[model samples]
Target chain A: MRVTPAVELDDVSFGYRPGQRVLEGVTLRLGEGEFVAVAGPNGGGKTTLVRLILGLERPGDGRALLFGEPAHRFSQRRTLGYLAQRFELGGDAPATVREVVSAGRLAAGGLIGPMRRRDRELVAEAIERVGLSERADAPLRTLSGGQQQRAFIAKALAGEPSLLVLDEPTTGVDAETQESLAALLDRLHSELGVTIVYVSHEFGAVERFVQRLVLVRRTIVFDGSPQELPGIWHDPSHVHA
Target chain B: MLESEFMRLALGAGIVIGVLAPAVGFFLVQRRQSLIGDGIGHVAFAGVAAGILLDVSPVLTALVAAVLGGVVIEVLRSRGGTAGDQALALVFYTGIALGVVLISTAGALNVDLFQYLFGSILTVTRTDLVVIAALGAVGLATVGLLYRALAAVVVDEEGARVAGVPIGGLNIAVAALAAVTVALSMRVVGILLVAALMVLPVSAAGRMAWSMRSTFVLAMAIGLGSSLVGLTISYYADLPPGGTIVLAAAVVFGTAVVVSAARGR
Candidate 1:
């Protein structure tokens, strides 16, 4: 029997306002454990597309599915990990890194209870994986941008999600951090066999490891292996080329 | 006065409200809605007035009215900015106006209304003590059991929502807790000043907080200290406990500001 795709969008269309379209007639399917890079120019609906997959929005037309279930109605939330672009933890927020990361396990732990020992171990391992074990007790706002991103990655990793989605996870992060993030994603995808949907305008550090590269410009303009990307369209950020 | 029954009852009420206010108000201050307690308190005043007019228990009536008001404000806030602001203003004015009209209609206008508006702790009865304990218990338990979820929600609301945290339900639950806190505090601080106890202590403790848990604990301590101290001072000076408690909290907030600044935090 054929296994259900991790994510499938059938003729999806979405817009923030009525009678206007951000994306149109988009159809895509991502298999389990596939490492896909979604890139497009500025103003493109890259964020909107993934939001639909995450069930944060409904399609203006057609359907978006997660593991063959309707995206919005899917109840297995622990199976999906999402790292939002520019997630704001207040400047003076007193939440420690460990506290922030442990929230990722909320789906598994359920509401109103203590975090079990195994869950605590997973949270520790997630922090260790992101190379932030020492800073776990520090307030999240006290960390540098790159370190903060790593903590957020640890948060997503703690969930042990089958489908991991990150939206511009390295926008303001330095080159060193991007490289580390790419390595982390590589390990998460290859060794653990986790499906990754990475959305960004610049390919920056993730280009070589992605199994499939898809360009979004209102619709799917390109869908193929990274090796198949034409030299003229080498730069993912400049879609006009 | 220390040997008097009324003094003991009032102190008991003070202790209950002191612990309840800041414990439940931490999220309100963090969410930038420190004034919400004030608004809920105003609505509860109207609830008190309604109880007087209807000859029912003021605490129970205030609870129902304040909860309904809290739910309304939350729903308005979910509609996003500007709308919520306008709704708060409308609710604020209507609360006091309805309260004035109801109290006048009850013919106890100045004498009884003064007690609810500014508080007269000497009037607190055994029934009031029982009610305060029960309601305070509910508010404290909700905050205790739901601490992590509530903290997660305050940190990043959308992030928490995607993580499957019940955002809307928890928001209403906290509002209800605020309403309950307001009602429980009516005897100690009165309707006008109960929100002050809720907000000021959290603000004071916010400066010294190293983590969310630290913030919560410190806020509770600051609130308890301010309440007990204010109550003792008022008993000696023959002053209103509501005004004295608020003044004590303000003094605590000012001290916290100066101290944190001096330490370069």
Candidate 2:
């Protein structure tokens, strides 16, 4: 039997309102331990795709599956870690790095219970992985942009998710921070064998690490290896190119 | 300070509400929904007036009305029918208008309205104390248990939902907790001033706290201190307890702001 894909979008379509679709009949799949980068221009439904895969929003048509289970019905949410774009945490939040990371265990221990010893260990481990152990107790707002991103990454890593979904993880960071994030993603994929699906508008930074590319323009316009990117970019018929 | 039995009961009730207000208010301030307390207060006033008109217990009626009002605000927010502040304003004005009309029709404006509007802590009975204790316990316990989920939602709602946190249910639960907090605090601070009691201490604590947990604990302490000190001053000065308590909290908030600015935090 074939192994179940980490994520599968079978002819999915979505729109925020009626008759104005953002994503239309897009089918994609990410196998276990695969590193895929979704590249698209602004308003190309990259974030919507992430939302569907995470079950934050449902598909208007077709299906979204995570580990062979339907997106909405998938109960093992602890297995998926999501790093949203910058400004996602809002301004002036008072949560510390450790406290924010520990929230990842909410799915494991639930909302109404105390954190166990194991949860604490996982939180510490996650923070250490992000190299923020020294600043674990510091408030998230005090951190720089890249450090805040790492803190959120630690939060996602705390859950020990097998499938990591990141949406524009390097949007507003400097070039050096972007390179660090790429290196971290590489390590996460190679060492931890975590399946990463990240969305980005900037292709040069993450192009080397991603094995496959799913270029979207309100639909799955191109789905192939990174070598085929030039062909799509050169094609005059692709309006969004 | 606690010489009279009435004073003892008032203190007991005040202490519980003092802790409960800031506990719930931490999230309210963080979420930028501090004015929700004012909206709920107005709804509770309508409830009190309805209860008087129907010859039922006003406190109990206010509890139900406030909860319902909170749920309405949540529903409107979820439906995207109105903006968050708009929803609050809608409920707030409707409630106050309904209350005034009910009271006018009933012609019960002599003493009952005065007590509900300004509060009468010295008039708190044993039954009121018991109700306050029970409701305050449940409200505070809910906040304690759901602290992580609630905080997660406040920090990043979509992230929390992706992590399998039930955002809608938890939001409603929070609104309900706020409703109960408003209802119970009405006795100590009155309908007009309960929101101040809930928000001012948390605002002060937010300026100094390094983390969320510290913020919560600090807010509770500030609230408790303000309540006790305010009650004492009101007793000696013969002023309204509700106004005095709120003024004390405001003073603390101002002091906190100054100190934070001095420390450049």
Error of 1 at A196 (Å): 1.6
Across residues B1-265, which tens digit of lDDT does each residue of candidate 2 receive?
6778988999998899989999988888888788888888899999999999999999999999999998887777676644765876788899999999998888997887988887888899999999999989999889988887887777766666777878889889978998999899888999999889889998898898998788889999999999899899999999999889999999999999999999988
- Estimate every model's Cα lDDT from 0 to 1: 0.86, 0.85
Docking class of 1: medium
Candidate 1's residue-wise lDDT over B1-265, tens digit each? 7799998999888888899999988989888888889999889989999999999988789889999988887888777788778988898889878988998899868777777778877788998888888878877888989887788777667666776778899999989999988877887888888888998998888888888789889999999999899999999998888899889999999999999999997
A1-241, model 2: which lDDT tens digit per residue?
A: 9989999999999999999999999998899999898978888899888889988789999999999999988888868888886535542447898888887777765787578888899899988888899999999889998898988888888888888888999887887788788778887789789999988876656667789988889999888877778754632422222
Q: Which ten residues in a row have the lowest lDDT in candidate 2 chain B?
A: B76-85
TM-score of chain B of 2: 0.96
Pairs of residues clashing in candidate 1 = none
Residue clash pairs of candidate 2: none
Candidate 2 stretches greater than 4 Å from native: A87-93, A231-241, B81-87
